[model samples]
Structures are given as structure tokens and as C-alpha cells.
Target: MSQDLPTTSYALLGLLSFGDDLSGYELKQRADRTLRFYWVSPAMSQVYTELARLTKLGLVRAREDTTAPTRSTRRFQITAAGRRDLQRWLSSATVEFPALKHPIALRLLMGHLAGPETSVTLLEDYLGLLAERRAELQAVRDSLIVDPHSPVDRFRYPRMVADWGLDYYESERAMVVELIRRVAATDT
Candidate 1:
């Protein structure tokens, strides 16, 4: 069953596994909050599309919520089948190496064409943007560490991943600083 569905479907299932009966909009918001750090957050339309697909596959169940007093909204939850498939995918799926598609690195590789000044400027700009992203991820990490002493904290793994991401950003920032120095030295 997992073979037929896109990874986004599984991602949504994982979101629902957190025990929240969420509308399509809520799912998208959750994705934006967390997935945007390491994965592509699906667009709102894509969220609805995947939800509908999952529902049709019996992996998700949806019911109309007329309690809004304005209009009805469909709230979705994962079914037993969804949990089984998610666990199967988690345990048995082949893990592939991460693909690096850094636009800054690509541009830096063609630095001779853009000249040293442009290259240095680009790396400098990236440093500021990197800091901004690090701060955002830091906030998320801070939120997750509310009960650090608890071994059974639900967000333990996510907090660890966020820490890993923060470390990666710091490493990348150091490398970019070194590259800027090299580029500036070349300009002399």
C-alpha cells in the first residue's frame, strides 16, 4: 500500500499520527512549522490533494465538522491501515543519501565568471541569511526542549534533528566565511 502512495502521503500520515484530527489547513500549517526546516512543505492545494488520495486509499478517514457555525470543514485522521503502512515504510524502506543542491555552492563554482567581488558579496549575504534561518530553527528547538528530563518526550527525536540542523548551519557558515576570505585574498 505504501508503494502506491507518494512520500507526501506518508508525511501527512505521520502528522496525523500525532493524534490531532486536523483540517487540511492545519496540516499545511504544521508542515510549514516543522517540515520546512528539512523537507519541502507542500502547498495548500497539494495538502488537500494528498488528503483526498489518502482517504480514498482507506489510509485516512475524514468527517465534516459543522461546528464552525459558518460552514463545514473536513477534519482528517489516520486509520489503522495508515499506521501499519507508515511503520512498514519506516522500518523497511531503503534510505538514500541526502542530495545536496546548494545554489550558493553552484554559483561559487562559477566564480571566475562573476569575479571575486561578486563572489565575496554573495557569501557575505548568505552569512546573514544563514543566521536568520539558524535563529528560527533555534526557536523551534527551544520549544521542543520543554521537558528535557523526560525520556519519553514525544519531541525528543525532533529536537535532536533540530540540533543536527543547527550544527549543519554553523558548519556551512564557517565554510562560507573561509570562502569569502579566499575570494577577498584573490582580489588583491
Candidate 2:
């Protein structure tokens, strides 16, 4: 229960606070499938490392699953203290804006170096990635809407954030499409 844990620590705590009793692998999957779209996605190693740190700090309870075939299998859940810390952090004002490390944005900025054709190719490739992510987000949102009693129903505020991400992605895609059209026209 440190006062100033990294945001990633709180992120993991927030995930654990969901009461799913997820293993590290499951946590990693949940993050990748849901949070990675908007928030910082930790590597597998970072997940495990943070789990250990949280365990040491008594913010999370990790139990070794002896019955499981895999050795050293651990499932973790947030402690009461962890929940309090997460709640406190959630209530706190924003410390900073989200960092943008968009490779596509950087490439687009330097598109002149590679010429319009290459920029067009990059945009197309980006479209493929964006489509995949958008579809995944939509499918999950649709499933949540269809099954109102699902575990995800608990995430009221998080859903709003997800809505924002969907909108952001769509807006980004539209802008890119326009950029590509402009570039293609100039190329011709």
C-alpha cells in the first residue's frame, strides 16, 4: 500500500478489483483484448512483475494453484486495501494527459520522405490494423449489450471510456481515408 504506485500498478489493481480471480495469463489476455486499445498495455513480463510487486505490497492476494497441471500457477485478486487505493486514484484529478506513441502518426508526419505511393501503402496497412481492432471492440460491445448480466455489466464507467475509444478510432480512420484520397489524387 504505497501512496505513489505507478499508473500501471493501479491499472492492474483496477483489473483485479473486478473480482474475476484471474491468473497472470488471463489478466494479460483481458488487458490485450480490452484495455490495450486505449490504455497502456504492459508486456507479459511487466504483468508478472507487477503481480509480484503487488503481492509483496499486500495489495493483492495470490494463491498458488496446486491442482493445476502447470507448475507455479497463481491466481490473483485485489485486497481490500488495493481496492481503496484504486478508488482513491480514480477520484484524483488527472496527473497528465495520455502519452501518444503512435507509429502511424510519426510515419504520416514523415510521409514526404517515402513519397505519396509509399504513404498510401502505409495508410492501407494501418487501415487493416484499425479494422481488426475496431471489429474486436465492436464484437465485445455487442456481446455486452446482448448479455446484460455478463460480468462486464459491472464496468459502468469503463464502458463510457470504451465508447470514447470507438469514436476516436472511427474518427481517426475517417481522417486517414481522406488523407489517402488526397494523396492518391495528387499522385495521379
Q: Which predicted model would earn the best TM-score?
A: 1
lDDT of 1 by residue, 1-188 (tens): 54656777888898898778999999999998887788788999999999998898888999999899799999999999989988988897778687677888899899989999999999999999999999999998988865666667788788889999999999999999898998999989
As for candidate 2, its clashing pairs are none
| Deviating ranges (above 4 Å) for candidate 2 | 67-72, 146-153
Q: After superposition on all CA atoms, how large is the RMSD of candidate 2?
A: 2.3
What local distance difference test score does each model get? 0.89, 0.85
- TM-scores, one per candidate: 0.92, 0.89
Error of 1 at 88 (Å): 0.3
Residue 110 CA displacement from its true place in model 2, Å: 1.6
lDDT of 1 at 106: 94
Q: What is the lDDT of candidate 1?
A: 0.89
Please give the range of 10 consecutive residues that has the lowest summed lDDT in model 2: 143-152
